[model samples]
Target: MLRPIRALAAAAAALALVCACNSASGGSLPGKPGDAAATRGVSAGSIKVGGIVSMTSASGYSKKDTDLGARARYLRANAEGGINGRTIDYIGAEDDGQDPGKNLAAARKLVQQDKVFAVAPMSSVTFSGADFLEQEKVPTFGWGTLPSFCGPQYIYGFNGCLVPSPGGTLNQTWPEGIGQVLGGAKGKSVAIIANDSDAGKFGIRTFRQGFAGAGFEVAYAKASVPATAVPSDWSAYVKDILASDGGEAPDAVVSVMQTPNNIGLFTALKRAGYRGLLSDPTDYDPALLAKDTTRQALDGVHVLLQFEPFESANPRMDQFKADIKAASGGREVPLNMHMLTGYMSADLFVSIALKAGKDLTVAHFQNAARSFSDTGTLVGDRAEPKGQKESFGCGALVRLKDGAYEVSVPFKCYEPVPFK
Candidate 1:
């Protein structure tokens, strides 16, 4: 599912597929009075919305917290006077089960059956609905880790697309932050690996260049591991990695993989005595620490973060914590990157919706989003139209040390390199 969606998205990107349907110029839905399509999911006092999330998957991975994160943001938005006098009629998220068919079905259900005004926080790796949602002129939001987020007029990534087309700018945060951890990338070497899937291959392409651009010698870069299941043994992979750098282990190893894969790979690397920098984009959740095996496996590994760390004293961080607590029935929960994915996805949608003003319509929303900009968010300053092309270029590194997470590099913006 992830592979096919990415292949289609890549083909779509080649043609520069940016079609803001019915936006502002000459469409009946663009603020035309009495046009039902203009107000399909709107009422005098409410604006209906829904989400698509991979809450359950065959790989035993879940993004259930993403739904909760969206709920938290929406709850606070409602409490704060409901977006220009209209409450958000959030119908909640539909579980896509991470299947391509299920993903498209969920999107159709939201648009055709539930009649949502928009799909916010669409936090799933397999976004098979991108084409359908874009065709139907529905505004969709999610993390921009996939090709679908790039060059799509109707779909937007919360932090902009980290993986962009050639000639587009690449977010150097991960590479730059990792360089700081390694006392700079000069004379250093790294091995980058990912699951053997289209999405993973795209990640390797983007990041291999990124790390090399940051001045590290790319010892080995490959997307050769299995995607559907974690390998029971990692000796073959380990053998290649240890001998990647001129027949010696590289200085650092970076994984563009999810939790279970990271745990398995990191545990194997540690056992093999390759004690250089180990890092991944996922596995920052506190819940992993509860399991001694997971915590030990991830110990000393730095996790890349696109937003402010939870330990930050920033007032906005406090607000997010409070919002999550209230959303969770006053219970404290472990925070993770998936939660931020949903929160920021919702945040971006809410920000644009607010700009859309009292005349709520898909056209109005698209127009507003085209020129939307905000400052001091958890993900950093956001400016649209530009975001559709490049990332915000801000991130941090957090290391799992001694059963706790610490900020290895403070959140900051980095200069981006061309994606070529």
Candidate 2:
């Protein structure tokens, strides 16, 4: 659900740009090998930055708060004295509307017109701007759910890359955490479903191996659901799923899809009288609780969380809540994963910028990122180059009971299984 697309056409079209894009060649920013003074967005007193978020979308799935999240984090950083005495001049994020063309256009506008030093919290399923950002040597930070976050020197995931190439390690968090909830993964069976898109296919491949490695029988794994539209009738999917485990339903049903899809699928499964563990990565939002149908549909469902849950006592979580409240004009607001998405994305950028030292250039940022590592933060110990290849191997699971969310599993780092 971290990277949801409307259809295969969108992903295929966006990925098509990868071939035409240039790849970074070294630790320093490309183009001007040694000239830090000529960096695009760095001024003597400020470092200008921007973001690209799916603030609006055709399907009505908006991550609009992501912009506010980035703003809050940046505002906090500036208030705390900014990086190396240069306050971050955040011009805010552009709305991609979850379209490939618009995503690319927004990236171009940010770099070419606004000349942002970096693009943090670039949240959207259609990231056609990845190639352009890398080619331009822009240091971008975002959720590493997509393949673009992996193997890219100029791009980073706030929590490290979720999808990595062969020989790279896989995050065992999802499987291991789920295992903990079900007593153990020893003989549990799971049926995983996703959209029939590039990201969906990749998710199935990565997660299938992860679950199997965790000792679960992947009873049914497929990226067959149509991505363009949510099916009003999920009977076909439910029918196959109920019998996926040798004529009986699996012990758990995992949906690697967004809110709309999860709601439909989970509702169908429940109506079909299949009482089993239902899990997904995207339904942790507090906003969904307002609607009775959504609340009932997702009741008893466990959602994946790459970061510490809000219910956590982690001091960093408290700081995030405070920052979020301040960003929302001192008004308490409903929290969602999208807000964390932007906050953490900006946090990583700020962390690396601080390590970049007082010089504050693209080259300095890249140099700092090459050896960056921090511990006990929200996402666990973050290490780069390594993060560029694998996840931090940390996470937790939260379940919706009645109308509130409770941490089903404690936040902790787990040993990652090697991805074959």
Candidate 3:
């Protein structure tokens, strides 16, 4: 979930003194003298980086492979001559356990204790340490589902900020792709549901505008489900959603929640005899197909993705698969979206750091980030500053059918619709 804007504002004000001190240091914090590394986590022989992920969570959701994904990317980078002659000293990852307090504690350990140069592949629902990292001027990379990612100079979202504040544009992938599947959205209707969390609420708000902008009648939009627990019974949500649009099921039901919630809701909906199209941002993981029940629950459901699907024939995807296999010691594992999130997050950070030149520091890194722009990346054409506020405007939709995924709406970039 995204951090609350009010909380971020409050913390920014409270951390003003720390931020000032850190900024004045010019990216050089007190550490070993004559290190010749220019920064805290850098040394003559290596550049140290760490990660934060919700490897264990209360909702049965885990981002464990995110560490593997980052490791894979870093291994490949090191194999390819180690990011300008300095091998990456990846300190593995710290598990936040999906706790806000733990998240902050982990961040503190990485910065204050570990003295790491940067944090990459930070995949967690709660990012309470965001303010601390910002105050310390630490460069962080992760998925931009949180508002903390937006408008933060030190934090970067791999695919750009998915949750932009007022005045920023919204990615039209989900709504536009759904519209294509429904032929046209002229008189069609949609119901958007999410967990009762900041991320879910912001997702509903953004997608409400997105679908409406694409001419679909928004029948129901709510963050009613609990975020911390998966509902065993979805009767209440199903009843309201099924009858949301003028006493009938909407043409499409869009879930902005994660997989567990989706499985319960979709299964209940199917049992309740609602046959409309099912769609969501999560549930793209191939691991979910390991269970017949899980597969059946998600059958014919469209999954939205910000990056190219693993099933794609793109050369970049081929390289990604190779890297994953190499990192896993030739073990073939199910490809999931979390892996991509971690891989892409690390990839962006390394790309910018490399551009920062042989002598790397936070100052150089931020400078490189400000001017960083790359086209034809796994996600999309990426640029800094603007990306700090908005998305790269690229994504695709895939559907699960008969225990396999197929391109329902081919990968493409769409012009973003301004968020109202």
Any runs in candidate 1 off by more than 4 Å, and if so which?
1-37
Could you give candidate 1's per-residue lDDT for residues 1-420 as a string of tens digits?
121223433533332233212212122235557443467688778888899998987778888889888889999999999889889888989999876668778988888878788898897766667777776778888888878787778888888887787779999999999999899999999999998765687889999999999999999999999877889999999999999999999999999988998999999999999889999998889999999999999999999999999989979999999999999999988888888888989999999999988877777888899899999999999988778778999999999999999999999999899987
Residue 114 lDDT (model 1): 85
Could you estimate the TM-score for every candidate?
A: 0.93, 0.93, 0.93
Worst 10 residues of 1 by lDDT: 19-28
lDDT for each residue of candidate 2 in 40-154, tens digit (9 for 90 to 100) = 8887788889999988765567888888889999999999999889999999999988777788789888888887889998998767787778777889998888778888789
Tell me the tens digit of each residue's lDDT in model 3 across 1-420: 222233433333333323222222224666544333658788888988999999998888889989999999999999999978999999988999977778878988898888888999899876777877876778999999877788889999999988887888898889999999999999999999998776787788789999999999999999899988898789999999999999999999999988899999999999999989999988998889999999999999999999998888988999899999999999888889989999999999999999988878787788899999999988989999888899998999999999999989988999998876
CA lDDT, candidate 2, residue 390:
95
Candidate 2 at residue 46, lDDT? 88
Instruction: Please tell me which predicted candidate would have the highest lDDT against the true structure.
Output: 3
Off by over 4 Å in 2: 1-14, 18-35
Q: Which residue window of length 10 is worst by lDDT in model 3?
A: 17-26
